[model samples]
Target chain A: MTSGDESRPVTEEELHAHADGLLPDGRRAAVEQYLAAHPEEAARVEGWMRITASLHDTFDEVLDEPVPARLSGLRPPSRLWPRLAAAAALLLAGLAGWWLRGALPGGDAYREAMLPHRAAVAHAVYSPEVRHPVEVGSDQEAHLVAWLSKRLGTTLRVPRLGPLGYDLLGGRLLPGDRGPVAQFMYADPAGKRLTLYVARAESGETGTAFRFSQEGAVGVFYWVDRSMGYALSAELPRAELLRVADAVYAQIEKVPG
Target chain B: MSDRDRIVELIPRLRRYARALSGGRGEADDLVQDTLARAFDKLHLWRPERDLRVWLFSVMHNLHVDQGRARRARPEVPMGGEALLAPASGGPGDVLERQRLIRALEWLPAPQKQVLLLVALEQLSYDEVARALGIPVGTVMSRLSRARATLRALLAGDGRAPTLEVVR
Candidate 1:
């Protein structure tokens, strides 16, 4: 039988079972008696009780907080770009026979600017891998750094992911608008994958801004620091992505330019 | 009432449930906001006859699970900045006790924490929790039993199991 069957130190499952109030009367009574005998364990249970109490104290009040105006019946502002795009789509439908070359002046540049979008799509496709998730494992950090840096013509640092319960699975080089870009993949024990796409910043000042963009089920968080532009794409919730992005930002900040 | 109005009405309960589930005020508010956004977006799918609060809660639970998975992907730098640890006191200590409690909740896996909060704090019926968690009623009971027993042990500071059966 497994160690779980023996039940030496408390298993997380058992802890959960107890907290869930699922134990049989006999087992529950045994646990309670055991706790009564063990003061330390009883204190921990009390702590849990207090936490539940505190949670109620803290948030039950929010029930009375008025819902924000923006959330209730407020419509998000309609940006100009989408309207222009809709108009263009309508116009394009009428001129089906004619090849409208250069219909928009920055059309090519716009397509090129959307490299992060394409990369986001690719990231959503490949990040869910179990075995062959990354082309280079973080074990070869030095090599991975040298290769990606030389290829992208910018210094690259592989962020440490120990705190997030993930280590670098490694990275791979992928094609981009300028040339090859590096995709670093990280995975947690639960097999959730997050991809960090690093490429040379497009011509402009590196803006430190948080921008949210989405396509299909995937979300892309793209930002530029110095001459390097980073895009983190995943199918995870937006808040979680922001947390990962914060970690990536912290690690990237520590690297000397 | 419009679905949006109904959802707006549920926000307070949603915040309370989220706070209980996360074991912290900040994270709980974040969870509630996410749940509200999702519920609003998927309002068409909500059946009017069904309980809106429970439906919002399930969304919040799923969001928490998704967030947990994502956090696992990118580890952050450890903030070891020392805060004062609580002194041994019989009654509820200070803010430190609350912090310790939060940390302990974090130690439990997501499912267990969710189950415990739903039943114990939210006072959700076993049937309500089972439906919210998409698990069987029997599974809900077992999970609640295990969670309560574990919390009892953790709080009691004894590694031994609890002797009291929690009658719902």
Candidate 2:
């Protein structure tokens, strides 16, 4: 609502704000002048004011009414549930100590194992989309790559998959455990989409070995290369996905490494 | 601090709000008890980053909506329990008008009544009302305007909903 110029009349929004005492003094004065010139609108505004005043008068006393004992005595009974759950977990761990040791992946092994599953989950969430498949489209691939590289603090590249019968569909930035992850999407001739999720390696460690993991229908091929960890996730069978993963690996490895 | 203590502090204000919404002290106390129980059970869903008051109001509003739906399904259930009794110390005329005001408030659509009460009674800012109701600021402005208009018309007794018989 305009309150700047005399020519810019006060609008309905301004009037409502004034009625509610939400407008600044300057704007409130402008609205008052407008209402003065308009008697019917002024009358309506006065009615609204009266309504608020009456409402306040009618119910303000409830605030001072002695709160019922039932309400004051109410407390969440589940406050200790978290502590109990934690205790149970510790007990289970202690009971199965010998069997669990070396059986469960922890530390670096846990990170290496979970990375692909995260990529697969991201794929499951974004794939099969009719619209908004990527935050930035492939037409602005150069800008997308530069923006992501800047955010992740790394020189990132979008690998071309033209020979693999999939076209680059651009990328989006996503939250990762350690830092930001840059995910690039590609669509095949059949319209099936795959994603390449890249993020900084934990502790700057590098692992060139390509490992596979799957969740539901999605399969992921992830590896840590130099300062970055990369995961290529798709819903295709393992054999078909392996071929695409190899191509992606080769293309990414050749980026001035 | 635990959610229990945080919620306990808000009980007075919550009771006040329930009193206004339910239109009777007994019903309002019942509503408040239900709301507190629901809030406690759903405490895990609350995020520390969000405003606790607004979240509690949202839970209470949802519970009220569910109760309204169930009430509507059973129209045979008699409505209007004990009339919202304002003390007669304000004089007979003032008492009747106050009773009329409370009755008019109950007759207003739940959405408008909510916006009006949050702003007029609770003095919540437009943004806070929007967050509590999960509506946009623009909607808040419009709904509030409509609510106040309906309230004014009803109080003026311009022939809308049936007038509740004021008990002596």
Candidate 3:
């Protein structure tokens, strides 16, 4: 038996297993007997242990380095508001909270570069739900818009995509790398999803070139307005998604305050 | 913790493992991104009693295996490409010892190198490694032993593992 108490002649596997501290009590004792008798084999097994220790030293730093936002699909729900407050304070002081941005180069470059990808990741993560998809369903559209607007510190509008074959499916409050963000979900007649990602743009941020990034399976059309960034993401073709984004941008632009 | 929280916590270890398998940071992160996508897509397959960490590791492992099969029949990416050459942490000190150890690892057959890392770096038991890789525990032990022997030979300048290309 693999865990037998009988000190059957130890195999080489048992010796290394001894080095790994992986042997069971019975086999561990037997291997201890073998290693006690054979000094050379004991020394080699010790080397394995040392190698294993140094491997941790070499790689564990990755654990502390911030995970990139591109990989973070959603920040935990409880962490949203506090980070939003901190992000707003940093924004007022003309600093964009570089500490929260991870190792993605410097300043607004991280946001400018990562916005679309983050949106696409969020879309891929949440847009597929048959249940519990939105925190506030469309039945409560006024409350949803007001709550999200309060959290995001801006006026909000849900674009009417009726002409474009998609209808409002409500929205959720999410934690962005820098602050609280909002996602407005829409669905076509066949239940295909499109999400609009909204976050506060840094002060002094200029209007963008209207970038389109294909993040894995999702296509994202994203841009910066005067004080907000927007990314409309979906599995739709580029032209189709662009048309929808243009309509959304136009409606959002109509919000006066 | 929520499954989402646990998943977020495990990203770094997944990246470190990806770095071992595929060397470039871009490639490693891409691998991790892909892994996260797959894990979320297959989240329904996971049982509540199973180890999420191990299950996620297997998701990454199987995803790579499937992607590997698609790209020209290669067993895996060419090892020792670039991640190992960079210092694993802090400033690049002597790094000679670390380099030697990594070089030895790069020389190992992909299977052995994988088993070795799963054991040494991730601290997985043979049984867990077997479960993650879909192999028997006996096979995990044999590959690990072979990996040890090969590492011993390469580190001693014997150049024994045919799979490793000696950079010197």
Q: DockQ of every model listed?
A: 0.21, 0.31, 0.24
lDDT per residue as tens, model 1, B1-168: 766666777766777666656565666666776676677667779887777877877888788778883133221212331122223354454555556555545545567777777876676767788888889977886676566555545444443332323211
lDDT of 2 by residue, B1-168 (tens): 767788888887887777787777887788888888888888889998878998888888888888883133211212432233222345323767677677667666667778888887777778888988889999998888777766665555443433332210
DockQ-based ranking, best first?
A: 2, 3, 1
Superposed Cα deviation of residue A14, candidate 1 (Å): 19
Judged by whole-model lDDT over C-alpha atoms, candidate 3 comes out at 0.73
What does candidate 3's lDDT look like per residue over B100-146, in tens digits?
66565655666776788889888888888998888998899888878
Q: Which regions of candidate 3 are displaced past 4 Å?
A: A1-6, A74-257, B69-94, B158-168
- Real interface contacts reproduced by model 2, as a fraction: 0.64
Q: Rank the candidates by TM-score, best first.
A: 3, 2, 1
Model 3 interface DockQ: 0.24
After TM-score superposition, what is the CA distance of residue A193 in candidate 1 from its true location, in Å? Answer: 36
Q: After superposition, how far is residue A64 of candidate 1 from its true place, in Å?
A: 5.2
Model 1: docking quality category:
incorrect
Encode model 3's per-residue lDDT on A117-158: one tens digit a residue: 667766766776544568999999999999998998878878
Model 2: per-residue Cα lDDT at residue A38:
93
Off by over 4 Å in 1: A1-55, A58-257, B23-27, B67-93, B159-168
- Pairs with steric clashes in candidate 2: none
